[model samples]
Target: MIKIDELREGFGSFWGSVSEGWDRLRHTAAGALTRFKPGEQTALPDRGQIDDPLHFPAQSWSMLGGDVFEDEQRLVVRIEAPGMEKDNFAIEISGDTLVVRGEKRFEGETTEGRWRVLQCAYGAFQRTVPLPAAVRGDEAKASYRNGVLKIDLPKVQPGKPTSVNIKVD
Candidate 1:
């Protein structure tokens, strides 16, 4: 027979593990999670207006998962941003941060009935990631495929220090 105290302890351990996982995720992906609201003119996105406004809320939130890697020659950033065209994305470097901005338009059924569940977020979103080293932003190249945006930026090489010798008086 299992004692009630033991059962309580087991449940507490499981919940503690779950709580720790959530805290770790929150810390690692602090700015990756974003909230997007409906545009001024449209309720949802560029297309796919919800037939019943009540079915969907005015705002929704989604997470953009990404990774930043650095090598001896260059730095690479890959972001998971589905449901968008290649033209929709705009990449820029502000200081030591890499900024990715885009809009994920909703293309739902035009003749649809009430949506059962609308969890996907729409509208414009921006995600910024800090870089480990200074990069040559002007020479950066980017591509989008398979719902992923990859950016390759060459690292800026440091100039050699110039030394001068003063004549002794």
Candidate 2:
């Protein structure tokens, strides 16, 4: 006679909530620390606007800005880099880390009155994205259109291994 085994309902999932909470806490700390590395001058943003949670680091993004998606062959990164020109931006990938850097400066003088409202961010900014996997660093391509920077990262193909039988060598 053959016997069937009952499934374990929630063995590992029991700790899922706790583990997820712990990861969020750790990710926040890591993001803060990494944003202040040596020689990397950065500004700590004040409490974000209540109306714009997307401007806050806690809810902004995963260093990749906006939406980042992946597929079997490519990783697509869409960054919100508004108020920038092609020459004012740069995309560089070193090892597993991809860095997007640029500066935005509002030029031109106007003599009307004192400033009443100025909210858009200006000055040097850098966003670093850690790739989901080691990509083909050489074949990465980027393009800027309609105030968005899109990066296409091709996945590196893993070579198959072959087993050879040896008689006597």
Model number with the top lDDT: 1
Deviation (Å) of 85 in candidate 1: 0.6
Model 2, C-alpha of 14: deviation from truth (Å): 25
Clashes of each: 0, 0
Q: What's the distance in Å from true for residue 93, model 2?
A: 0.7
Expressed as tens digits, the lDDT of each residue in 36-153 for candidate 1 is 6565422453225445444444566788889987777888899999878899888999999999988777766767465645677887788898988898999999999999999998
| Residue 168 displacement in candidate 2 (angstroms) | 45
Model 1, position 95, has a per-residue lDDT of: 99
CA lDDT of 93 in candidate 2?
85
lDDT of residue 169 for candidate 2: 69
Model 2 lDDT, full chain set? 0.60
